[model samples]
Target: MSTAVDDDLWSAVGDPTRRRMIDRLLADGTGTATSLSEQIPVTRQAIAKHLAVLDRAGLVHGATAGRERRYRVDEAQLARAVAQLNAVGSAWDSRLDRIKRIAETIQRTGGGSTAEPDTEHRNEKE
Candidate 1:
């Protein structure tokens, strides 16, 4: 997916309420706004809005079911999201490993204390 689309997806999932809504839909296999609202603390209208955002992000699919629309997680899109998360996590892990190695090298070379002390605090005390 494009970066814009990826950003939208991430933004959609970034909200705690929306993430809980996704969890509810996944746990229940499917849910309507009314049904989800009953389980969640939000109103049905709020749930509908969150669902709309999820739909726009391609995280969930909705279909008309009688008077209300039913929503379910989109497995393929979810997998793609998971893949993106894993990629990001791996990149961070690599960066942290490099940072750890650098810190170890600095400690061994007695360069870890290269920074000056907090002279401002000493001046304030005086």
Candidate 2:
């Protein structure tokens, strides 16, 4: 079962601003909300709000350092996101492989009718 954590992560990353903040943190290793705001067009308070969503999503975590809290990307959460994407890719690959095999069989037999004949490859090498 998928948890709310997944939803939050997806929602947080679904926005361009939040994604930019994440990218900034990744490129700079770690940064405060104010620092991220300076790199982007949003205000510091807006950046903080985006960071809050990221924090809830477990994509990022912040800690106190002197007078400000520093935010950093959580690699574990990123790994989970990558794994989910890879899973979808694997499923699509399997489906395409099945379609290819079926296509080859139909081409060889030449008697099948109306069975997804569109799988014929235009760019395939013989």
Candidate 3:
């Protein structure tokens, strides 16, 4: 039972461009499509498209400021993303720890591998 946030949030942040956009917005406090395009390699239209995706994921919010739309990273949503990432990292750490224990046990028992040759696949020449 994954929530909408869990699903779309990754998709939105998965793009390298969007991630860069988020970084820029965070660093600059706020930015417009034109401003972001200047910092990024893409055009202003592309920046707007990326911003739209981020906005849909609730990672950013935009406010109309005169002629341009100013975008900023949503603190709450960013916090949520960080929490999710931490959870995934913790899970992987636990899995690695278990694997390390298993390896250590095998090493201690000296049962890691057998030196015996395979008789089942022996040829007539053998």
Candidate 4:
């Protein structure tokens, strides 16, 4: 995923209320408006609103169970989100590894300016 879109996905999931709602869905196989409302502090109306957001984000899918509607997590979308996070994490890990390698090389070489900032780009032949 592009970083901007990936970031937005995480931003939507970043809300504490939404996180709790996801936890509730994960723990329970499926939930209805009334069922979710009972577990959360919000009212049934508020739960519906949250559910709408989750649906738009592709985090949850709701089905009509007779007169009531039931909602469940969209595992595929969750997996996509997980994979995106893992990719970003892997990239950062590589960057850190390169930084450590540079430090080790400097220490082994015994450079005079141990912690000096990069000055090679500066014009030195005055």
Best by TM-score: 1
lDDT order, best first, reads: 1, 3, 2, 4
TM-score of candidate 4 relative to the true fold: 0.69
Q: lDDT values of the candidates?
A: 0.91, 0.85, 0.89, 0.83
**Which parts of model 1 have CA positions greater than 4 angstroms off?**
1-5, 112-126
TM-score of structure candidate 1: 0.85
18-105: candidate 1 lDDT, tens digit per residue? 9999999999999999999999999999999999999999999999999999999998888788888878888889999999999999
Q: Runs in model 4 with CA error above 4 Å?
A: 1-5, 66-68, 112-126
Of 2 and 3, which scores higher on lDDT?
3
lDDT of 3 at 47: 92
lDDT of 4 at 98: 100
> Between candidates 1 and 2, which one is better according to TM-score?
1
Which 10-residue window of candidate 3 scores lowest in summed lDDT? 1-10
Summarize candidate 2's per-residue lDDT along 18-125 as a digit string, tens digits. 989888999999999889988999999999999999999899999999988999999888777767666768888999999999999989998577665444573363
The list of candidate 2 runs beyond 4 A from truth reads 1-5, 96-126
Q: State which candidate has the highest lDDT.
A: 1
Write the residue-wise lDDT of candidate 4 on 1-126 in tens digits. 433336656765877877788889989988998999999999999899888888888898999999888999998887777887788888999999999999899889985474766577454633
Please give, for residues 1-126, the per-residue lDDT of candidate 3 as tens digits.
222248689888889999999999999999999999999999999999999999999999999999999999998898888778777888889999999999999999887767676766676447
TM-score-sorted candidate list, best first = 1, 3, 4, 2
In the order shown, the candidates' Cα RMSDs to the true structure are 3.6, 8.1, 5.1, 6.0
**What lDDT score goes with residue 92 in model 1?**
86
